[model samples]
Target: MADKHNDISSTELRANTPEQAVLSTPTDDIHVANGAADKSKNQKIRKATNIILIVVAFLFVFHLIADRYIPSTDLGRVRGFVVPITPQVSGEVIEILTTPNTLIRKGQVLARINPRDYEIALFTAEQNVTQAGQNMGALTANVTAAKAKVVNAEANFTNAKVQSKRIFTMVEQQVMSEADADNARAELASAEAGVASAKADLAKAEERLGSEGENNTAVKSALLALEQAELNLARSEIKAPTDGVASNFRLKEGFYANAGQPVMTFISSEDVWIEANFRENSLGNMQAGDKVEFALDYAPGEVFTGKVAYIDYGVDWGQSEQTGKLAQTTGQTGWLRQSQRFPVTIHFDDEEAKGLRRVGGQADVMVYTEENSLMNLFGKFWIRVVSWFSYVR
Candidate 1:
């Protein structure tokens, strides 16, 4: 009976298959559900895209305003005068008076070389100077005696002129013979010859002693050598040039310090400044003397005050130094170029920043170029926020 009913149902379904079917199969229901699901998915995608666009736009607008009014940069460094301490005179380091990371004052003795050798050099120089002076003084006395002889000769010549004139007058008046006049003329000529001879002797003496005269080149050279020796002896004891912290010390007792070679690095605390790289667009109103706020990575939750000491006119990007040859410019790979950064030097207004500053340390800086209350307030708050963020940095 079931088989007969199934056969009858199949025949009825086939007969009503054209367009008059009252019941639907499960395949058609599945197609309709898939269509609804696809439409819902597309709607969700569009909504998400709109939300993302809105967020991006908001961020762009916020950045533009913040950067324009309050120019701030995280690419900042705590900078100061980093002096390389080099010994002016070379010697074996006998004593290291300065410890690493300690504050050093200007002119403080940092290290001492084996000063015994320098002391010997100084003594030798002094002795040589004294000997040269004594030798040159004897030669100088000869020249002085020669000059006196010349003066005496000139005086005798003058006296001979007067005597010759008197003798000529006596001969002319017939009171003396022509022989007396001739003898007077002969004496005058002899006196003139004596003067010439004395001058020649003086010249010869000067020429002989000039090589090592009292104030001659040799004496001057000896004096200069003596001065140089003294300077070298003083330099054996190395002194600090500026107040700073001695760091990265590479010297110890028994070490040999070469002349003009750096032994340690001195990070000068004097004139501490921040070198902040800022985008060109943000520097529209930025210039020297502008008020600035900054923070350091070492001191989190603390902001420092400063001013724009100066702004770099340009950067050295893609630039080669003068080498007497044309620079072969290299082509960039990208279709667009990135914004260039200029260094803005900020000087500390408060002494606290100078005390806490370090060379090449990380910093965040904000320059207040304009008088916008909103921007200034935001900049102050932003710097503090950055300061707190340094805890993680």
Candidate 2:
């Protein structure tokens, strides 16, 4: 019986050992759990690393955009000079020396008027002056001749007096007749009358000369007419006042140009500037002499530098709403007021590249300003108060 029980127990132990071997061998499960844990840790590490990288990239880009390359505001604009040319005299436009978009220099003749009429008028005026001078000269010569005649007459009168004296002495001595004395007296009287007439003629000539020298209305009128003729003559040739490009040149050969008529416009490309119509609110930090940078629509790649030249005296707020302004001018369009805009002029320092810019071209401008510490702090506090009040309301 003991031998039989031992054989059965050995067999059971062998079968149980196989089952235990299957349950106890846990190496594969351990490897799988270890792999899962490693994978989870790796995923968490990758997510954290990605988050860090994203933050770093964002900061770098934000810094670049803020410090180095700030976004431009298209609200800015470009401005330039616009001038009108008008004729001072009335005449036919004989020639047109410029075309549209043509570049020209200062003092360059853009057009000419029909100069024949002006020339003829000038010649007539000159002739009138010459004739007047000749007339004056003739009068002067006449006076000179009259003076000589007066001298001759005086001499004759003296001789007649001497003869009369001799005749009187003879009569007293009973050697000459009283008739001879009477005749000598009559001759002296005639000589004296002749001298008086000559002196009167000389005085008349002197008066004529004096009239021209002092308050001669007729001479003054003539001089004014002559001056007008000369001015008209000068107006025949249209010359530019400064070096610039001529535009709106509409006059052609043989076209009549009237007085005070618009001939053409001269745009000075040499003096370039940007007139920014900034809002009144935007002007709080803006001032003259502030640094500015600009970009032009025509030349997008170029960065033009400038400074604030001046700010407007007052804001134009009327029609400000329609015009999108922060302030309004008193006499502006509307009465039920809205926002208004003030104009600020900025002068460009670069002269070399000014020629490339055109009037009315759009430009973006930026005014460099330092933040005000007190103002900023006050503004933040005010904003928070306003927000709280809005919520309460």
Candidate 3:
């Protein structure tokens, strides 16, 4: 009975020891606490990510709204009116008075053609004018002499008629011979012919003299030719038509310049402007007088201000390509069609445009619309950032 009792007590002790060891172990509790801590940290991280995504989405929407209202163009260029220097008259270039890339004033003599021929022509024209004046004087003298002759002829004719009439009367009274009466009739006929001849001479003299002595047809024609000769002489000296710089001037002393051919290019600095190309969809709010900010590659990091001067009304899309009488359509059709860009002219501020010689230079432009919003400030900031980058790019 004592051995059985000892064995049962040992078995109970072993079972109770195993249960106590399981309850007092600290490894399971440590694992459960670590899991709870990991779950809490994950929850916090997810919350932060969700907040960040929401903020980014909101900012993106705002940016879209701002960009939709404010139009901008990455493709812009400095433009100005290019004046082609063309000669009006054809001649050999005898002298070039202007140098290439030199500033010239209006009416300044740029070059000279061979003026010897023109001078000779002018001299001939002057001689012709002098000869015409002498002829006019001679014609006047002739007219005076003819008028005097006409007066003398009229007097002689009257005297002859009177004498004939007296003779006829005498003959009728039987105091004169019949031969004398026949001779008197013959004298009357001669007097009538003399009177007609005198009247014709007077008419001829008046016709030659014309209404005004100095304004005779021949004299007027000669004077017009002289004026034309003088004009041609003056045109032989080519003159600048405007205040600008002359470019591409390759004319020398002996080159024969053709009439109406462009010899050089004149770029007018006073009429400089910018031509910006904007997408068609971005011009909904654009109007004349809108403010513009632009950056030129030549003037990097400097933002120049300008105002919208005009918007092109016509574009190539609406233009019809004519194939004979039929209007062939040139409209583009594709899944990824390119957006058409139209030109907008911007006039720079006079003060800011000074000292900038960037004609046909690349530029980036941004147009600020009338719409006001908080995002517009951001848009301006972005533009400023781009301008800053322009320094390195």
Candidate 4:
């Protein structure tokens, strides 16, 4: 009985011990080796992540510094269009040739005025010119006739003088009658009077001819009349001055309009540009002739190019004179004031602009005054240098 109990206990102990021991052998060894390798790998990964984060932080800080030192402005409100139109004559609207928002070419007829009155006035003026010319011609002919009369009068006076002298000699010798001599003397005096009359008539004719000659008052009146006629004729035709889209048509077809009244206005679509108003403080690095890059709210995915063409000389709120003193609130610390804004006009160099489009569309203009990093840094440095130099000098 004792031997049997001991054998069963030993068998149970061996069974439990062999299975447990065999199962734990490879697991324990593998667990120890894996733990060591994982610790090493985790340390390496953390170190690498920390190093990458540090580099990224440094780069971010550098970028912040660069942005603060460099001056930048968002000028998005500057835009304008060219207005080119003028009325040369005044008349009543008789015909309408264009509608609102219609595209018109250069020299296209825009409207017509009532031409009947103008045409009649032109005809009357032409008649006046023709009459003046005829009067001048008639005066010139009279001058020639008066000159001939003067020559005939002179010859008659000479012949009468000779005959009178002969008659006086005969009377002095008592071979001729006194009445005859007296009559001859009277004839000679009458002939001399005729010459004076003819001379006076010739002078009058010459004066009349001169009055109607070129550059004379009568001729000037005629020319003025002709010009007025031509102007009236021209007033009948209303034409566009340039290629543009018509707008603001206050007069319509068959509408009666007076002189100096505007019939319509047009906007050219080809000359569009952006006008950016940047703060005065942001102008330190800005200048004319700088290239610009810009975008528009209307057209997306399209990049536009332009050049800075002008900058305003001064800044003003453009308040009316009746308004009181102007002031603005800027968030800043005491003892310093914020800079004001001024306007700058940028011209687009794109083919779309050169094609005669109406400018004045709203756009944002960012001028690239400094293309390189070094240039941007040096520009700021130069401003500070000039500031210091001003104090020293």
Candidate 5:
């Protein structure tokens, strides 16, 4: 019975010993468990890193595809012929007919120079022409008078020659004295000199007369001066060149305007376009006549349609009228280079856009060079996004 009791105690001790070992565990086993937990944490970190890399790669590829298929740019401007309103002739501003920022029709008078000076010039030119005509008439009369004088002098010369010949014959026949014949000869010589003088006066008169009627050189020159005076007087009105709006109108009633100097800003509304700057790499499929869409900064949440007019071929970064200078060195010399941008002209499909044109206005543009539905849809969404973002901007 004691041996049996001993065996039962040993069995219970063995079972309790296994439970104690499980509760207390060795340092080596604890280290192993800690290492396993560390491994599991490392695996979780690696999985998160891989997911992030995949997302980044996908976004990079998507950007490449979108950029290639449907190129978009926020660097766009509403471009038109913004001309400087310069006076053809110089004068003091006497009156302004046009109001500020008003629509002016073609050939509408914008302002007027002091016409008193031009009026005086026109009057002087008219007087010069009158004087020229009067002079021409006097010259014609002088030619007629000179011709009559020449004929009279020739008749006298003929009469003197006949009388001298008769007197010489009479002297030779002993009917007249030598003194009388000498007197007749002297008269003949005098008559001949008078005829020569009269002919010279007639020639002088004819030469001064020039061509007949309006063909006269002096008359034509006077007429030309008169025409120029009229032109200058008309130019003093300062009419608008085309149908458009005016700006920067600092011209006043007393301002002195110089010839060929800009006094006001006039933009032509006949031709309007969007000058969009697009990245060079994204312009692979871009060509003229491609469809386009854009949004103006002023008109937020509005999408306007257009067509690609043309793509610029060159950039004049270093070109200038000034010369004899070395080229400027590039600021960056790293392996990565900044992308080059080229201008792409776009024409609005909306006819109302022309009437509502504003030069130098900011815009966001997108060019669809191909019929890529997915990419184009993305582009449309992108531009509308920009249009909505314009409100925040």
Candidate 6:
């Protein structure tokens, strides 16, 4: 009975011992080491994640600075001067001398008007000038004849006066009859009246002849009419005023073109420019002579460089609209307002832009300011990417 109790107590003591003390083997050691290894790996992963996050944050900040300092806008367009072609004289279109989209030079004849009426007018004016000249010649002849008549009458009057004085003396000395003296007085009176009439006629003739040969009032007036007629005849041919391309050639044969009305639009080939509508915030560092790069939709995959030529001083806001008697105010939505864009004109550096005929075509523009940094390089890269994307988009 004592041996059995002792055996049972020993078994209970063995059963009550901890498992770690009873089973302290290699497997247990491996399990403990694996737990510690897992904890250390988690700490290393957290450290690496923290470092990556810091780098990403720094990069994001750098990109933001790049976008702000270097501004860009997609709302750009090719621009050129548009001229309205109008005729100075009203007439029927006798001929159309130009075709649509044809290049034209200054003073090139675009069309012709029916000049028959103008020619007839010019001929009539010339005939009137000839008639004026004939009339002037007749007046000059009349003046010369009147002068001769005045000289003859003056000689007769002088002889008559001498005879009257001799007759009066003869009557007073009783060497002549009273009837003879009376006859002599009558002849003298007739001669004096003739002389006075001749002088009046001469004065009238001289008044008709002006200071110079062609300075007669009638001749001058006729000459002016002739000049005007010639001018009108010349104006019958419509000519271009500048070098450009003729567009919208709608004038056909027999169409009556009104005076001073636009017949076509002429796009000047003098200089081409880009009109970029940039947000107000983007214009802070922008100025004239700033370098710019642009890509056109028509000329995709090609980047053209230029410089900022000018900035618009004003924009179309409430100030431009015609308002009522009361002043107008601009309405805005809360917090989510869009910035207004102003126009900035850019001029191309080379003549390559002249090859593009797409006026008002879409373009992407980037203005490189005086600030030279890595940000600009990024901006250039971004623009190149955009230019490439333009090919597919």
Candidate 6 lDDT, 1-393, residue by residue in tens: 999999767656655666645675557779999999999999999999999999999988875565467789999998988888888888899998899887788889999999999999999999999999999999989999999999999999999999999999999999999999999989999999999999999998989877446689989999999999999999999888777788976878999989899988888776678999998877887899988988888877888889999999988676654556666677777775988899999998978666674677889999888667766888789888888877787
Best by TM-score: 3
User: Model 5: per-residue lDDT, tens digit, 118-200?
Assistant: 89999999999999999999999999999999999999999999999999999999999999999998999999999999999
Clashes of each: 0, 13, 0, 11, 0, 0
Q: Estimate each model's TM-score.
A: 0.73, 0.62, 0.78, 0.68, 0.75, 0.71
Best model number under lDDT = 5
**lDDT against true structure, model 5:** 0.88
lDDT: the better of candidates 2 and 4: 4
Pairs of residues clashing in candidate 3? none
* Candidate 4: segments with Cα more than 4 A from true spot: 1-74, 77-92, 211-216, 269-273, 317-336, 353-360, 371-393
Summing lDDT over every window of 10 consecutive residues in candidate 5, give the lowest-scoring window.
Answer: 19-28
Candidates' C-alpha lDDT: 0.86, 0.70, 0.81, 0.71, 0.88, 0.86
Model 4, CA-based lDDT: 0.71
Q: Which stretches of candidate 6 lie over 4 Å from their true place?
A: 1-70, 147-203, 206-214, 320-324, 333-336, 371-380
Residue-by-residue lDDT tens digits, candidate 2, 284-342: 65678876666666664566677889988985333435455566445546654554567
Model 5: residues >4 Å from true position, as ranges? 1-52, 88-94, 152-192, 251-262, 316-331, 350-352, 371-374
After best superposition, candidate 4 residue 94: deviation in angstroms?
3.3
In model 2, the worst 10-residue window by lDDT is 65-74
Candidate 3: tens digits of C-alpha lDDT, residues 1-393: 999999777666645676765554467668889999999999999999999999999988875666567778778989987888788767899988889777778898988888787788889998988888888888788788878877887787888889998998998899999999898878778877877887788788878867555588877888888998898889888888777678877788899988789888887777788999988878888899988888777876778888999999867776656667766665689976898899999999877757574578888888887757564576577667777776787
Tell me the deviation in Å of residue 117 in model 1: 2.9
Predicted candidate 4, C-alpha RMSD = 11.7
